[model samples]
Target: MEARLSKETVLKLSTDHKFGAEGNISTHKVEFIVDSDFGIPGAVTVVNGYDNEFFLESITIEQNFHFACKSWVQPKKLDPEKRIFFFNKAYLPCETPNGVKELRERDLMQLRGDGRGRRVCSDRVYDYDVYNDLGDPIMGDAYARPTLGGQHNPYPTRCRTGRPPSTTDSKTESRPSESELIYVPRDEELEDTKQETIDQGKLMAILRNIMPAIIDKIMGNEEVFDIDHYIKESGQSEFNSQLPLSRILLNLGGAVQEFFKFDPPKTYSRRRSHFLLDDEFGRQVLSAFPLSIESLKVFPPVSKLDPSIYGSVESALKEEHIIGHLEGMSIQQALEENKLFILDYHDVYLPFLERINGLEKRKAYATTTIFFLTKMGTLNPIAIQLALPTGNPNTSSKQVLTPPKDDTSKWLWQLGKAHLLHPHMRYTLKTNAISRQTLINAEGTIETDYTPGRYCMQFTSAAYKDWWRFDMEGIPADLVRRGLAVPDATEPHGIRLLIEDYPFAADGLLIWSSIEKLVRTYVNHYYKNSNAVSSDNELQCWYREFINLGHPDHENATWWPKLANPEDLISMLTTVIWTVSAQHAVLNFGQYPYGGYVPIRPPLIRKLIPKEEDPEYSDFVKDPQRYFLSSLPSLFQATKFMAVINIGSAHSPDEEYIGGRNDVTSWVGEPEIIDAFNQFSMEMKSIEMEIKRRNADPKLRNRCGVDVIPYDLLIPSSGRGATGRGVPNSVTA
Candidate 1:
């Protein structure tokens, strides 16, 4: 005589009514009795789940007739008019008995009559009507049907069970008012959106050719480079007629190099440069770059451990045990002490630890260009080498200059180290606006002038926690001699994409001093303020308002609320900035304008028509900006899909898990969370389908000699999915 609610029933009810503290509807177990004459259920009492409020109002006879119920208790309290509506929709386990007699006879079930009340009562009465009869009795499965004017449901709805198929004509079907259909996107509107996207793609292709050429021309010169020169140069060239000024500077800087190129001293050899090109120097440069220890070859490597080992949260919690030394300290307090410890940790302890751990020696590159004022003149040496750093500068390597092997040279070197190590030295250097690039050569003599030579180096920003630190106010001579010191020319952490610093290099490139400013100005507005219909709409607004900033209406606009909170906003923007800058660093750090591609790959070249026949094909270029914007939806969509998978797997006990801590399903086990995740998946899938439909036109495919449909470029190609090279079976097919 007992029945359980199906999972489908719970999910639908939860979604439709809303749950938790914010929900509009509440559940109640109501007592009712079946009328012998009408074979209909009449409500006796209804109790609300939230406040235990009882409602005993009489229900209409017509509603009872519509419900076609025998004596039973309603699962939850509802309006007297909607009692039948709720009863018709709820699903019950099929094992329950029938009729009012069975409902009253349930006392046949044993009970601990005198025992303390159980925390949870499974015996609460509920009668789920599986059949709804309007004319004649008919059976229904799940979900109660409402009249045509009833509230719309998100679930897949069906017609009333006993009702015959509507004989309504096309005119009747078309009679619904515009407000009833307002949420649906019209076919014409969808088509226009599709066309707009294609137009953006077309415009991007044209700019691709124009933008990169502008960067190359500017970086190749020794003189001050200007975008105006290129604008004039482009006017004479018929192909560059419509190139936009704002578009060309999308890389943040109008040019890739920091300033007009300062050619490495001609005597420097390309092949034998032990400077920044050497293994040691490369390591030092990477050290200054913003990255976590996990990214930079962490200890107790993940590859060596079994996946099962990471399946539990214990392992993740254990990793944080290293911070146990500051058990009761506040985050700000820990940070202050951590900063001091980090300076020594990176310079001395890190090297010592690596040595003891049998790790290879890492090269140290000069952060600032070293200048030596000799009797000959001022010479800017790209790098310097250490000689007997612990005792005195006079004792060692032939590569480093040791004048007269006397106290004068040693004393002068020490004085220079002390001057360079002064905490505020970088502030003065910024005012001078000097810039230099990493040089890869071992040929030049390591040289520096003691008579106030310019050695400007910016420290890494504070956002790196304590990872990229320096002994700013300490004796550099001893540290350098020990091969544990970095040059003053080094840029701060997170400045990998120096393009942002180009416009304000003389202002000391302090734009990244606080991520909050950027988040408040750029990230927040796009996420929150704009009324975008989709991710495309949001991204377009972002580019127009923040990145371009050339649009007049957005000049004074403040705030965007794309994400839920400040934490999420910070996390998202941090990822975007770090991703963009890291790639830019790879290109501009050593060889300027090499690799010429944006970090994230753009959407595949769209072939809208035959290459030779299409008029726009001649000007068709690859616009990375458009492609980058387009690709963002895929990331968000994929994240949703992955969450859905995790949620689905969480419900299955048979599913094999990789690691204790690594299993996302373990972390996201709530039923509500799973339902929310599925809803997002449905939305994203709908958007993906729309995109597919737009791209499905035959003309979009390359239809030359051998027609080939383009593979989905937005999806990542994994080695695990490759056929020949450790690719998975899914990708190979």
Candidate 2:
């Protein structure tokens, strides 16, 4: 066998010899010659060394030679016999890349040799008509049914060059020749043809089987080929109630998927979410529930005891653990009144007051929260009464506006409409304790709901401000004279609770609601103007300006120096909102009686129980007032951490929760979120100090109903009370 090596192969060999073990061990190597054209060794010679011990030298050289051949030995042209044999041998069968063996005849047909190559005999062996007698090539299956295009006809004929083929030409017709014509049909064939008549039923059935597919293809495979056809054919209009809300949502989601891709652009968001604004859906949900008083009647207070409180003051506040016990007898009375007391909002009033003020902003914030929580199924029948100012101040009492007939009706009113108050009224809205208690009673719901039941709400402007104030005639006569029995201060006014005291406070929810509104504002604005916001910087800039961060007229804003970098500020703000919302959730729905019940003992009687003393300490355990007052510092600390979280998750949009998931599936209040909160808390030393110093001031603490002990200690350090293990004691120093 003759074998040829490529230039690379020879070079490789030389490279191996020069660089391998053979090169190292050998001593006969003399010179290396590389071909200038091919870059390979042209010649190599290894001569024996004169003083070699035993090895002989190797010499390799390239040489070329040619000899004249005798005249008679060479042929002038290819011999027929020799050329034929050689051609046959050279054209031997071989496997093609397609794995098919190539035939000699087929291979020969593909080649031409200057019109001098011998024609293979087998090329003409297969005698078939390539053209008709008229010399035009026959095309397709001429034996099948005739077609207008001659390409499909079995027979073919050349057309006259001067003009198109005439219909009058017998050759142009598809009729078969005399020999090919059928004269009579066989009995079986006749019967078969007779039975082949088209059946309407079968044709319709076949069409029904294939029509959908044909329509789908025509419609680009859309699920709904025709909306009217689908609705009418499927009887969808009559089966509306048969579909579950979840199924509807899923269907809506599917429709949304069809239009807007779930895959967000290569931006920060992991997934796109659709948020339905408060509208008919909100109303429908509210309409499904009973009115506040009625709901209270139907869904009675749970018999379960309060959650046991444990952890340090900071941890307790941050963790939202229970602290002290409420006097059972008095609790029963308050429960009868359907009044649930909330201490956090009332005791730590400064932060909220600083963050949110003014009737308009407060109304917007409160309304937004109510609607949001209502959607979350946390609050129930919410009654909001806004008195539209009538031009005539002397309008009859009968003409005065009243609270909505029910929450569903309240839902019918728009936010702007709900903010309008009677000119004579002083407050935004007036809600009774029954509705507030409804919220407290529904704390440990399985659904993870945050909405409270029906509450009386009123929207007013300044007419009755003094009546609702904490000083002078405005103070609730019962609260000042009987509730606390504290002597009226000589001075008229300095600082006081803005509203008359209720049996319970929804301050956490109130503040949380504000945060919730702010969060929604940002998120909604982000989505609404998502197209305009192409980058993180743009989004932050848009939000800052939109929220009116530094504007003097803006009510909802940061009090401290604003972060110069909008991106940082937006991120921190998002984190704050997410963290606060989650924490508020933990406060409201994560446990039963998150802060324990209000004390039943009168203030005078509770004071009688010595501060440092014994068995009676159980009766005098820390109240919500003390718990909230002490937690002010920790609350501020938590706030700072929230800022940290915002900053951390700024660039990564997927890190923060959008409004897609409901309460149960939401990322809020999760352990990871809490961990993030804890991580940032340690960095807020100054904020915590300021909080502590302010809360510790004797005058302020006294005036604000603050306690002497630290917020961490629910029970007196000197004595034991009704203590039960609850939260893991993971308190930060």
Candidate 3:
């Protein structure tokens, strides 16, 4: 028979047995007994001697109310609260009960055994009440209700056979119906709970892996973060504010200087301001970079750099200049060397200096006159002229040489002569202050000495009114009028007389230097040689005729012997023809004050120079008639001419003549005339070429090279409808 054990005796035995083998036990198994009063299998609590629970296993209580027990030994001492209680019997009858037992009567179950010591012992009898009715009993809660719904018996229930409830007999009872259990949960509430669980998991993982440095920064750790310096250093404002002026100038000057180093470069250099006072040096620097000593001193001092050092730098700037530097001495030594200074001045310098006292005052007048003329003409003559008095040289009652009243008139006449005699003198007037002044003061007196080889020139004015007087009164009328002379009506009258000389004898020859010399001579002779008061129109006429005829071949004729060759004659003739034609056009069609009309005729000698009467000669002369006619239609149809000839047949006879009301047809109807002229000019050009070719061929004319095309035949026609009335064809080599 099994021994009957009270609950107190069982509890005491469990405690004593567990403590006695505490160190010896390597492994232990615990079991629990079911309490019929609680409808649960009561479990044994495995604990240390100090009453610290370690584990629990379930056993069973029989219908007679005896305790069944099991035991466990801990590997290490556990916390009293963490121990688990296990029931040795299945809770449900449907569950298999492999280890179910009655807790009241049992043999001494071996709870723990020492593997190392080879020790085995029957030890603790587990207290079943600890698992069944102790504080917070395992497997018992309000949420968990039994599936077997009826009130359970306080003592162990009988098995299905009405025998003692053993492990096999307990499973034999009819299993509780599955429908007896119930559960209720809100779907939405469950989903929210699940989402919160996932979020918490992610947050914990992130926090665990984050670097301490980054975490501290995010967490407002003052020692790890900085913002003040970063904000201040983020923009361009500070960089822009500190830019220096000297650096800008350096960049600009460097750019300009580099640009000037190229051949055929810009007229102005980058360092133009720095070199402003040195005209020659500026030009040299612009052209080649480093300037020679001779060129350097011309400019005023703007820097403290020694001239020699500057020269060295300048020389290095130009590849060619370097060679020159090397030829003298080492480049360094040459740069340092100082030679005797020779103050060289351009004609512009003196005039510039004169206005220094009051630059504005001088700039107002001197700049417009002297500077302008210097640029237009040459510097020497303008300087001399500007230096001269504004009045006449008085010698006696019979001799008074007055300064020229019509400067432009004299200049234009000289210009015309120059164009006629020396067509190669095509120098453009410089547009400096002096030239501007000359242009502005174009009406001023232009006195010149009379000489054989001088006459052709032009001048500027210092003011608009002066320019007007020259343009309106002097240029197209008195000075350029063909075969006519008109004296200046204003104060300080001066005469302009042309002379026939070698080169100057040619039509269209332009000898600019000769023109200048002639004007100079006129000034000198009138003041020194001639009795200025003599109003000998014959002498004037003789001079005019001599000029009009160009140079003569007659020996001892006043200007005949001066011509060097027949080539000179052709050149002069060409120049004269061009000048006269230009003048005629200006006077007849241009806006001159005289209503585009001038009372002038062709030179009598020009008219009287008898043309060949032969039909062949006339044909040759008229060969450009086709071209002339062809050009006329367009010329006459122009709006300007139409405006000029707007008056109709009802107008007065004088007006009618001017307005194209004679029996003659309108200019637009004269195509045939222009065609004839064009054909004639073409033929004339052909003939001219043939003559030149013949002259050039030594085999044809003993190499004498005489121009046989008659001067009169070469002259352009004056009549509107005539052949070859305008510009002739150009000659080419």
Candidate 4:
């Protein structure tokens, strides 16, 4: 049978195509078909089957815009409700000002493997309707649910929340047409759904009064519109009070957009200090799970790396201050034992500190915080160093503060951790920050902005590969590189993390290993062995393009892993899927619950540690608690960050997790491959239960503190909304 099709104007394409544009010729006999205008310079069309029954195998646009050369799709049956999208990248919506510099996919065999599942993921877009009448001001803002972008959500999460029998949790909320493309994709077969753009409207009738507040907060401020070094508060009125626990609900319940009111100095009372400066295990425990566990590294031999931003490594940070906490162990002994860790940000933020601190009320620093892993398997901060730029670039001014000896030092140390953790967010997303959000905006710091055009992909890729090492990204390797683990054949990936009970690495390794095993089985089935892997011209060419085109800067880097064998291929593919799924799940998803309390983990430190000579130092000395409040974000900034994270952290009503079914199993003929995927899914279910058990275990205090919220972020299961939990296959949130 000849493949035939019909078409419409070219909508944008979400190329995270699996079996998508591959043009694979297998046992199937139907010839690939396309529209007459398919190759034209500006083609806008969607392909439908002759009877709207054509399940697309692969798609190609040999001659066209440089942004996307080909489009492939999964062979999902189509009807009136389903259609394959060919949306151009230009028309795609972006939450950040800089449009998608690179569409998720432009090549057939993507840099990230799709053999396991979808390589490209997207978050659904929701229509604006704060009051269902606020209209276009908030139009197209991303919905704050853990949703995916597809025609249908096959495995919509069943929210299993406990209640007093009054709360209503949605079971089958539908997926939306719009999605924010989350990850890059690679090659594989797909039974993809045509992303449909539906014109729909819904509103919370009660939130009518709050619409103005939200619109003003998101759309009104120069702070939201413009970003200097200083982080500004979003607008919050007296009307915008706290919703029981949810900020998203607070605004939706009509408690937002009412007016602008600064969280008064008095409001920043002893309460704010209670979490950071006062609590015993405040900074240490949060780092293990929901926040940046990836940032920790085995304590360095040298305390400082950049002399321009630092004077000497040991001058400020000393051994005695931390040795006391290491259980009578010497500094060298503790480090040798892998018991010492540090979150170092001195090199990343030093340059930005000057600009970030230019504003009078704002204070930022390049910092480092050292930790000692306690016998309890929890990390305890021992020392913190705050460094400020001295304009010389050749010389620096810095101070090292340890766990408090006095009330003054206590507050100072807290400020140091805040200084380090705050900017860590900015730099961690260095790729995103420089490409999509912070620097890519037209008026951003980069004058020769490298985005919004043909070179956008190349520019971002080149810029991306330069900032960090790609080979060291996987969780297992990262752990080893940081000296937190040692090679142990018994362990996953032949490496065992030194911290036996570290929550992030522990939960993630379970998920990571399952993915590796499943992908290894599936890839071996296709490639046969190492010789086949190296001999495949298409695979080798794809490899070159991945290194040279996708990450040009690293093109000559010898450290890059090769797809020369099935094992090599398995390792690489597993990293890709694991990064996008479990890794992204852990790094994200818990932002609001852990950081929502501004006092617990503030993203922006509005004020710097005051010098005794400075006037603010007198005020700080008088009431350090109030001084800390003045130094943090204003009410508006806090709310804005909260709202942003809340939107980001929540799961959509229709999110598909790791084990959730896609159409992968039906087409593959090999029972082994099918069995591999089924086994992977089953193991994922097992992982979900495993994580639940761990969360409930009273012994794992890092996750199950009686007073703490369970660290369920890694549960390969999800339900609707931000439940401080759930891990989908991609970083949709």
TM-score of each: 0.18, 0.17, 0.15, 0.63
**Model 3: worst 10 consecutive residues (lDDT sum):** 598-607
Candidate 4 runs further than 4 Å off = 1-274, 277-315, 393-395, 423-467, 665-668
**Rank ordering of all candidates by TM-score, starting from the highest:** 4, 1, 2, 3
Model 1 Cα lDDT, one tens digit per residue, 238-257: 23325586755543353433
Name the best candidate (by lDDT).
4
What lDDT tens digits, residue by residue, belong to model 3 across residues 1-733?
2222224212333434544343433333233343344443343333444443323222234432222222243332332321233332223222323233332112212221121221111122111100011111122331121212112211111101111222322322221122321111111011233234333433532432243335454663222222111111222222232448886666566544333221111112233222112222212211121011121221111222233422111111222322231334533343343211111122222222222223221110111010001111111111101111112322101111111235432322222211111011111111111111221111211111101001101111111111222112222132323211234445122322121110111221121222223334323322232333123333344444443332121112342312233333323433333333322322222121111110110000001111257443343345422211221212111212122211100111111111111222222224443344345345444434443443354332211122211122122222221111122221100
Top-scoring candidate (TM-score): 4
Off by over 4 Å in 3: 1-345, 348-568, 580-733
Candidate 1: which stretches are off by over 4 Å?
A: 1-369, 372-379, 388-518, 521-733
lDDT of 2 by residue, 1-733 (tens): 1122223211112322432223354533223343454332212212212221112222222322111111111111221111110111111122122211222233334332232322221111111111112211123232211122123222211111111222334343232232341111111011111122212222432433244445545654213221112111122223233689988777666553333211111111111111112232222222111111111211112212112211111111110111112123333343344322221111112112222232221211111111112212222212222121222334311111122344332222322122211010101011111111121111211101111101001111111211222111112222243222233354232122221221111122222233334444444433334333334443455455433422212223243224444333443454444333332222222111111110110000101111235553343243422322221212212222222222211111111122212122122224443343333333233323433454355443211222121221111011111111111111100
Q: Write the per-residue lDDT of candidate 4 for residues 535-569, one digit (tens) a residue.
A: 76656876775565444434677898877888888
| TM-score quality measure for candidate 4 | 0.63
Q: Poorest 10 consecutive residues of model 2 by lDDT?
A: 597-606
In candidate 2, stretches whose alpha carbon ends up further than 4 angstroms from where it belongs are 1-595, 598-681, 685-697, 702-733
Better of 1 and 2 by TM-score: 1
